[model samples]
Target: MTNAHELGLPERVPAGDDLPAEVTVWEVGPRDGLQNESSVVPVEVKLEFIDRLADAGLTTIEATSFVHPKWVPQLADAEPLLAGLTRRAGVRYPVLVPNERGLDRALAAGVEHIAIFASATETFANRNLNRTLDEQFAMFEPVVSRAVAEGLDVRGYVSMCFGDPWEGVVDRAAVVAVGRRLLDLGCSQLSLGDTIGVATAGQVGALLDDFAAAGTPTSALAVHFHDTYGQALTNTLAALRHGVSTVDSSAGGLGGCPFAGSATGNLATEDLVWLLEGLGVRTGVDLDRLADTSVWLAGELGRPSPSRVVAALRG
Candidate 1:
């Protein structure tokens, strides 16, 4: 078999530093990816898409969200969809819950893990969640606390950590503060998002450095990057160099932030896997199978996948 670097892949960066041997990819295609679609995906299609992702060796998949149907009608089948899922022994399916009500619905659906989302920017917080920063925190406190108490693993998502569509150049310190608050709220991990896809590699390194300075362990952090400006892989490389192992990606590069109008899709899972495998980093994801799955999903969405790797491999 030909090695990845033999195909002209670049050498791993920051020359003497050791890259992580394995990275955990958190697949978000089902929830974040599909939520922004104009047409609602059928529940059966959503289920099969998730199954394909799992079969392709994704250990952690963000299946669906329990937010009110009014906000994301595309994911209104959260309950039934989750209920129909065939659980795998080592796989985790985490659902996004916006507030107490959402948490209630998720629990009733027998969700074992849940994620609460907040924003580093006030404008995004208001627009996305219809709550101010403080109110959003207040709203999530009990949800996180109660979920953790109930033996459900809780994850926190802090959106617009790098920049916001309405509020540009967010303060790194402010993003750190929100991240710390989420950690204090019993969240086991915090996923920092570049909601508007405005982050550069330098900014990503600096932000991770700041998080380290604030006593936030990189082990507890995951990076979610949008590919709008074509910097997602570059930014992911920077994060990996900084010891961040958990990455959020979508199959077929299928995602956009509905609230951030200018934003594009997420870093494609196949693309990320290609990069990681080329660098000799272990991701446990089958690239060819994942590409096939992306193609299948693109057919369902009635469009070609935005993933360059998927396109190239399928062609």
Candidate 2:
């Protein structure tokens, strides 16, 4: 039997860190993780993946994206995947809706929660969303409004919040501006994304300070980090210390941005769980189950998981 202690699960050692009592680990494996894969994952495998994640105690799992298939062909099974999903109590399944058309598809599929991706840099906004920096809000406004009207929760993702490949160092003001617009458009939460993973822990704290100065509470904020520079976990700790309770992570570190060449795998959920539990913060996730799930998914993908924690716990 695989023991929990043998799973490389961190011991609970409260260092008296100023962090949230309960943190929300928003699992983005099924959608964001699989979206960038060169080969399409079977929808059946995706469903089982979500079920396993839920059983591992992830409360919010991003299911799939409703974007055009021509772009993210890996998740073309979005509709069918949602159709076959057996919803569990106390678990929220949020899907990504690219536009009003995508929002329509999500609504038709009975999606209770939807997320919109926006960019903080002009170059990234143009490349990823086919809209200019400011123009992105125009596109999101109607989608967010309609979703809110339909009584659905909306999450806004602001990519390139810390740095951009083309634009170089991103201005904190620009990120706050984009995020404020998204929140003003009725998004219940705004997830700041280090799309290229160029952020440092200092940068994370500074940006959160900027949002706070701009009258945005940390309660309405989340952090999504990529591990390109190996700073994701430290940056996540910075966010948590800043009173941000929701952290977005991918199981087994399974995703990168297809649009952003510099973007790499997201902060791994297994790694995050170990860090949080070690700090004596509550995430309500089973480390042993999460590691086992990551191992299983890695086999399905025919590759080793990039997560250091997953690699260490693979015994």
Candidate 3:
């Protein structure tokens, strides 16, 4: 893994809850951002986009997802994509693994980090995971366990941490339960996802409070916000106030979950960078180059950038 100087923003962690001196951003542009495209982006395009993201100071990038092509036809080129990756010494490239099968493929590709996902609601869980909450946990118990034993950093995504379209008002109890279980099962970090972007700052406060009460340390959590209703930055500020240091954002705001009905734009990486930098929180990402990469992606995808900040910066 090569170090992306532009992405090395964790300088000095703020003491207490005052402010984080720096933040680490997980860039999901390549995997989550491109998955929903109606057109097939060439493997060359995907590789070039990743390199551009790296050049712009994105330290952590979700390179690709290893799922059945029948499910996500967009990522059918997973193997070739991984094989063609430009490995940087300090950059961390994590791949999304939907199941044990996906894990096998990731392992075959010599991947060192993998992300596994499950929703907080039954409806979303069944649709994305093809199983109930309990069943899904059973599936990951050993997968997470084995991944950890094998020295791979496993990330757990608990989607719909805020609300689900199929099941409204996700319960705080359910959120804490899944989060704790995944952490206990050997996930180094559990990313709390607002899949449909319906979360309010108050709701985010509620989740963090409950997670604290449940013995899940704040440091073990990461916020993954969607900008669907324009609450991403607000919600991120709320998370920061609560002492969370890591956030997941897509470059150019490129991804939406297919399982989430009415799911919309993700938090634009540029917007987050702007916010963090404005607050004087150290996020080593280059705001200028990131916007440039997003502009290129929006043109390549033949769509307007979901990020207003990207557009403003470009203009």
Candidate 4:
């Protein structure tokens, strides 16, 4: 288990003398964070938000989702949002696609990178997707095939990979089985999400090690955590020790799973950037700039930020 102190963060830097050989952080605040806000942020505001994120040195940002407006009304202007996006050469903008219809819309928007999500648990799948586990797999099979055919890079997100609130606990076997399928289905990378955010570092470590022992390559896997129990960075360090290089975070800790009651915002991008920069890991991100972005976003949403880093910096 990662030390509880790591799980509970304060405004102090750790001495990581021997850092991982390489690490990558994906910023998802624009899409994942803002999508849940009740205030309607306009497409122009979203575009500028993304632009500021890019300028803050985050190379990868989830732009928006192509889901039905009824499901996520916050992102209803996805089309215009994409149209207004000022594409930087090196930055890759990935949009989330719920199903075929979602992917179709994304294609029309001329997106090159796409993300699809599915649950590792059967009950969660039924609840989250309104479909059975097998049915979810069936949906991804075609999405992956057609997406690749369109020359789009697809990233798969396996939600509730570690645990499920509804089911009480998630089986590692279930995660591995679904993970292998997603990889085989042509997903270039798979991000394991603690959707309800109940993962512990020890559990996260053991799971990665188990996958390694099973002859699965762990390099293509990423960790997407929520700070529900203040464990995201702790789990991140543990995953890094296990050679898991990619991590997903949100600016200002802005995100929550609407389906799960206690799920809160994701690990703060500022916090992650500070930790990694101190560790001598080059995330190519500007911490001060990211802090400003988070603060601006909180004001835009007319709410307080969930990120401790932002609060500390604001002072």
Per-model C-alpha lDDT, please?
0.91, 0.93, 0.87, 0.85
Whose TM-score is greatest here? 2
Residue 201 lDDT in candidate 1? 97
lDDT of 1 by residue, 161-233 (tens): 9888787899999999999999988999999899889899999999999999999999999999999899999
How would you encode candidate 4's per-residue C-alpha lDDT over 183-281 as one tens digit per residue?
A: 899999889999878899988988887777767787779999998888998998888878888899999998877666667888889888777765667
TM-score of 1: 0.96
Kindly report which residue stretches of model 1 are placed more than 4 angstroms away from their true locations once superposed: 1-16
lDDT of 1 at 291: 87
> What's the CA RMSD for each of the models?
2.1, 1.7, 4.9, 4.5
233, model 4: CA deviation in Å? 1.1
- Candidate 2 colliding pairs: none
**Model 3 agreement with the true structure over 228-291: per-residue lDDT tens digits:** 8889999999999988999999998898986676888789998898778767788889888888
lDDT against true structure, model 3 = 0.87
**TM-scores of the models, in the given order?**
0.96, 0.97, 0.94, 0.93
When summed lDDT is taken over every stretch of 10 residues in candidate 1, the lowest stretch is 7-16
- Model 1, residue 212: C-alpha shift (Å): 0.4
Regions of candidate 3 where Cα sits further than 4 Å from its true position: 1-17
Kindly report which residue pairs in candidate 4 clash with one another: none
